[model samples]
Target: MSRRVFFVTCPKGVEYLLADEIQAFGLELVRHSPAGVWAEGDLAAGYRTCLWSRLANRVILHVAEVDAANENALYEGVLGVDWSSHIPGRGSFRVTFLGQNQAIRNTQFGAQRVKDGIVDSFRAAGAQRPSVAPKSPDVAVSARLHRNRLSLGIDLSGHSLHMRGYRTEKGIAPLKENLAAALLYRAGWPEIAAAGGDFVDPMCGSGTLLIEAAMMALDIAPGRRQDGFGFEKWLGHQPEIWLELKQEAERRAHEGKRARVPTFAGFDQDSRVIATAWKNIARAGLEGIVHVEVRPVESFTRGEKWSQRGLVLTNPPYGERLSERRELSTLYEALGETVKSAVPGWRMAVFTGAPEFGKSIGLRSFKQYKLFNGKLPAQLLLFEVDEANAMTPRDPDRSGEIRPRIANEERASMLRNRLKKNLKTLGQWARKQGIGCYRVYDADMPEYALAIDLYEGRVHVQEYAAPKTVDERAARERLAEALAVIPEVLGIDPADLICKQRQRQAGTQQYEKQSATGEFMTVHEYGCALRVNLKDYLDTGLFLDHRPVRYWIQTHAKGQRFLNLFCYTGAASVHAAVGGASRSLSLDMSKTYVNWARENLALNGADSGKHRVEQADCLAWLAEKPSPDQRYDLIFMDPPTFSNSARMQGVLDIQKDHATLIRQAMRRLTSDGLLIFSNNFRRFRLDETLQSEFSVEEVSKSTIDRDFQRNPKIHRCWHIRHLS
Candidate 1:
């Protein structure tokens, strides 16, 4: 009957929400800490919390607080507790020790000490010692140590409250039930449900959000479906009080089913997850209350019979991998469009680990909350689908002009003018030369530092990394301005634009994929067809600046045995093979690129036994002595400026290792064979000592095509040939 202190724990960001829930249940608030809250409550209060609190992970009944300066003190402090009153004779128990200090560095050690203390206390009293049970113990004790002080308690909530005994099947990354409830609370779902509003999740993986929302709307006690609580077996547990609480919860749940509940619906692209969601929904006794289907976000549509006002809540993929991140951007954009068109005037909340992708949605979020999805930091973005927050509709007449939505009109005009001028000049040249892909602008103006390239009808923009001295905010705003102007000036849809930050790449970073869309488009260069993926890598499959070099190889490769080293996607090899090379071999360390090269060759009808594509470290492969059959009449070596690939034998610094690489390649070259070596290292200086060793000539000026005339230093090339 006396008031006892209790500690309630929840997820990191759900402390405040849990505290509010505790107070709603008539428990007096004592204090709050990170991930937990202390409350003053009696046995009945604890029972009610365990039965009704939706956001709590566990409820612990505080027993005592004692000084624990060291291991000895920790053991004595735990031993001083009256274990006989809580643990029954012959009952199995477990100790959960949390936090660490210099005295007790390991949680396992602390738990062992606590167990020893409890066993010794029971033995000293001539009582049967309770057995230790790691799983489903009769008594679960919690010992928390902080600042040399220990607080020991009896856990009353067995097995986290998040396990509602319904979600037997889950997706790859299932959101916890408690966290899903917290998101609903933050998104104002309770109030919306009270007003008879509906709920929808377009990308719902396993329907966690939908189930949680349905429970809230129907007033179903979250703990009603729980198997049992930790307090059920404790000797001090009052069976009458616990029975009354459980009976009340059961009555409320029975009544809630008959109450007016809001519509709860979800859709996922994966039918497997949707089937799992249906099983979960059926287990929760909401099979008819909740509806789900296998529908992608693009096909998401509101039901004609559903309420017009509701919340569109979803936890879309966070794109943990770099490739997924780029691909998810378009997915997020589609979600935003779906929300705007399908649920206009409704409220929406998106929980994502990559918050930057929220901008892709085009809708401005009115509120943001920082939360953690497990260990990953995440954000909950709230938006109202009203006109004020609606995305600016693209005007048909102004489609060819920069949108006034950009704040800096003057800067926008400048970028637009520069792009127009470049397009007028280079556009004409590209058409006459039958080039479908080329750079239209390469950071022509310092303020707008972006390389805008056109591949057929699509546009790829690479924003050059700004100097440290430049304000990052200003840089971002300028990049936004450039993005806004480039699409209009190039006469392309904004959806066709793929923007990425271009920084100094090192150690095969450029070769790493930025996305996994696998959406490749074929573009023409010198009448040769090549496939380029604009959404995937930092650099498209085909490098446009190397147009002249590939052309030169095409013109002079007639009847020559060609070799392409560091051949990315085998673009150069495709050119050589098309130019009548008698035979060719392309070598690169990346298996992905090797497969891509084979695909590219097949796309151009160049994949034959005569032209082989092999995956091997060019540096290591070149170190081996080439046989007479392996020698080639002409060789092209374009190694990365710097690569420390684990596949490679050693680090490669183009400036430092070019001589060795060139010499290795020249060994495979015939006496009259020519070796075209090139790199994009701006500050590269060819090894001067090579002049006396071989016939070397700087052909950088001649290799640069018209599209790269403005940036002549984009790459450096050298012609190295064996001297007779």
Candidate 2:
């Protein structure tokens, strides 16, 4: 039995674990690299490792090492190897080249050179040349070049050992099999399993963790279910040794199945993933050994039939958006409470990309391991669910209680008092007027510079960006205090409060998405139902300041053909259609807003052939000569203060281009039609020449509603008419 050098690859942080695993397989460790380890093992040892390794990605038999300073040297070095001794002359092979050098900048070219070398070697010996197969082939070759040295090897584990041959379907953002196995090992699952401790995943996605845990408990080889390996077709493969290892693995698996392994259960809120999980468990041949259910974390309770002490392992969502992150805090808190009340004496391990969220779990972590979920840095926080670290279940009646205290109680109290007074006045007035959305507070106190609006029952808070003189830390503390105070004073759930930072935006920044939650709610204003998304954008779909303007359009739109330019979400178009406008056309450059407008109209039962929403740049659309039928009796032009949107034909500065915009829009208006032009530029002034050319009246005062009286300059509006 000649000792052969083999290189094993695993995830980045699992190199040491893989080293230990290789040593446990009776293979001598030779060297360690970043994501791979070299070990000295014979053919049988290599075969056993491939059959048993739970954390390895690939097992490569190191055949040759050569200098590869240049492409020509790389080719010649590979050609020196005796091709006939390894792959057969008629066998097809695939080259998986990794790394780059000054001479071989492209990995494909490097692989091509390697392939050419082997083919030429076979031809030089007057033997049939081997063909290349990009997919599965008779033999798979591994070529790694680093620091002008290349290591060539034969890949023994086909298609990565992580496949495991069971998980054909996976949930969104599933953990790779090897990574899941490493997490189980780090959480001390083996010892717990040996003691007959049960295993559960409260937020199992496709049951990867549960399946992996069951396999570990039953001493089942990770690759036992695999169909084939890369070396099966190699000329030098020892079928007898491979057969012996496979049979031993099968025997161990068969015996371990009846060896009194502890219970393994999984639960997920998503029913789709739970179905996929059942399929995966069945495929892994652990249908009876592992159990899964479509249940949420909050519904998870310790099973009566399971052991008293077990491991509660789960991978909860690490939110990628601000709103999701905010919502996940409550989820983590609920998870903490559920685990403490359900499995008090068990151990809990949480794997998350956002470790800060782990703090919300409210349990003291006894151990923490820094790892990676693919390229994202992640951590495994292990907690003992005993009395010392357990959290008391939250009171259902006080679920909305603000948990964090305000840093400055006096300032927060002042803000709270002000909010109460405004709500008393504005809330009463909004109800009287049948308005479902209104601004309750607008930076009335300079220290707490926030604009808080109430839409239906949800609160949308926008913190105005603090001035340069304000300390960043102080501003943050004040914002936090405001957030803590708002929910308390408004008597609303903290989860219903969506907060955002308000800053001066340019070049369509205001329209850019802040999150992808896609949560939209309907609110009523002036007998019209409007759709608003409080989380996804800086400005909710319906601008609260534009309330009176939309109403004004509704009042005067009867029997008119309406045109809404820079239409945004088309709240005004909806208003016009609802107000009995004969026909309406709404134009905006954003397809998202166009679809939203259509939805808004559909929601209000106003989406008819008479009402149309088109996605077009307002400026470009205004410049085009309108057909006679395109002329409208009532036209509303509310352009952004400044826009350099890529979809637009050119830059739009309200101050510089207002006159041109008004003229172009006027060209599409009937001789007796009215153009209601508006903008939110605080320093805007009507073009003097336009006032002289047309009958223009500044309706800013009347357009500013009572909710916006504090900031009367929120927007400027005008009714432009042609002098007949």
Candidate 3:
């Protein structure tokens, strides 16, 4: 307790905030560095910081600082640290070196030098040398080398503080426990907790945000459940001081009043994540405080009894690099809409790494906090959503009179810059190749740009956005200007370019439309279409992202009977029949799509003798036909993410029923047959334990279309080889 101790504090930026926090505990900050804040405090105060500092990465107690310019100096300096007092005679220790100076070029070599110094010191003292523990150590010694000065310290927190022990199950893309807590803290949850506002994470993945919020609301020390602290093993360990800190933390928890522990609720589209969130809630012992449900954002109407002032914190998908931002654009916009319509008085906090992606939500962030997830710098964007609009009593006559505000024009300018570069490079090649049709580019989210396809020297653009929302028509006009510039900039005839808008569909609408060139292609409920060129759209000739599995079927379908389920335009079956399949049956409940599939077969010169396209409910079709005599040899199964068409026997959930579908498909497959099942669900996880019945090899690469390279997980295909 008498020794001069340096406290090393690592926080996720906002050092002044942490310094202020330390100062609040009566510890004056001695110095500050990039890695942490340096303060002179006794062993007791160091332990206190580990327990209370909400933003610190970990706390370390300095053992020694010495002038160690060379290898010998480094060794001698480390040996002089008096390790016997900190670590017991022969206790295990790990030396982690953060190198910033000339003495050490490599971190490992520096660490080794420190290790040698400690070992040699013990040996010279006639005491046994302790072994090295890398993963976890009885004692953690950190060595920072800068300008020939060696600063060594003992890590008190042991493990990274991010592992808060609450999350028992990991959903797809679950936020790291520590990062989640940091996000909550960064979003000003502490103030919200003190103010009496509730917290809700509608897109909760494993209840991270909800649990973190609950801990904040209840004044629960995140480290309360932690079993050990590094100071316990130090030579000057003070049991009474540590106990007092813990008791004080407990006292605060008991004394904190949250206006009746404001209601915390989490909702997810996936039942699995909901179940995982439930387990996590229980693991955190917060089952009574936190509630989670399986519900889509669209179906999530605010609970009638809940307060309107709660904070809405969520980490919705950025779609990552795996998904096309275009595919999830509407979802993001819909979420923004939901927040504006459903939760009228709530504030919103969203954390995402993609800047372009943040714009996709349409709601401008009031403040953007820079935080990190491991090495990736992320922005915690805060939105002061005026749910006043949602709660407003609608005037039957005046409700439609409110004019919508324009989206940030700056973002559009940024998009224009990016499109300029892309067009400057790819436009000329497209026109010269007679590729009048192609996907101009895909929008990230919320922007909802028209999918431009050039057909017969004219642009067929599909404007996919809500009707009369903002300056959507203005965006279309900007796109038209962009399309017009493409031909001239690329040295193509300006007369060859024209623009037309493809109307947006609601629900399960389908239609065939002729463009300016009179070429007809089928369109589905989504803005996605089956076109034959590269100039007018972001994609042409069907979504090629599904190419790999389609080709997988073509290669395996020769002379084999095939069944293409969820056969959108029967693209896969056409590939199969073209590959000389003996017979192919395409099943889709959409009659328009069934006819489209037949047209595709005709376009490919496929004969009707071997091809049969049927409009039937896939699930019901499978149920009615029990025998395997007329079973398929090659089955192509691709399902919608979530669908509840009246033609179906029941609502289809791809994630929940994939195992059953795979099992059923396997039942109809020949001994050596291949069943290719796929889904476009971005975060789809296969039933590994269930799929074990069949040899399932992922054929994602084989099924990817060349045009869809930007979006790898546009669909994921698995090749099921029936157990022979």
Per-residue lDDT tens digits for candidate 3, residues 20-54, read 66665546688877757878766667777788766
lDDT scores of the candidates, listed in order = 0.84, 0.85, 0.67
TM-score ranking, best first: 3, 1, 2
Give the lowest summed-lDDT range of ten residues in model 2.
Answer: 502-511
**Better candidate by lDDT, 1 or 3:** 1
Per-model TM-score on C-alpha atoms? 0.63, 0.62, 0.71
Q: Whose TM-score is greatest here?
A: 3
The collision pairs in model 2 are none
| Predicted structure 2, TM vs. truth | 0.62
1-724 per-residue lDDT for model 1 (tens digits): 9999999999998898999999877688899899989999788999898888889999999999978789899888888889999999799999999999888899999899999999998998999999999998999999998979989999999778988889875223448989999999999999988887999999886788999999988888888888889998999899999888888888888888788878898998766578888988999989889999988788898798778789999998643223334545667777888888888879999998768777777788999998988877888999998767766322123324233246689878888888888899999998998889999998789998878899999999876656546786677778778777777888889999888763222223334765689898888888788888898787787878888899999999989999999998999998898899998999998898899888878877875798899999988789899888988998999887655455766555566678888989999999899999998876577777799999998999998889999989888888898877
Candidate 1 lowest-lDDT run of ten: 393-402
Task: State residue 642's C-alpha deviation in candidate 1, in Å.
Answer: 30
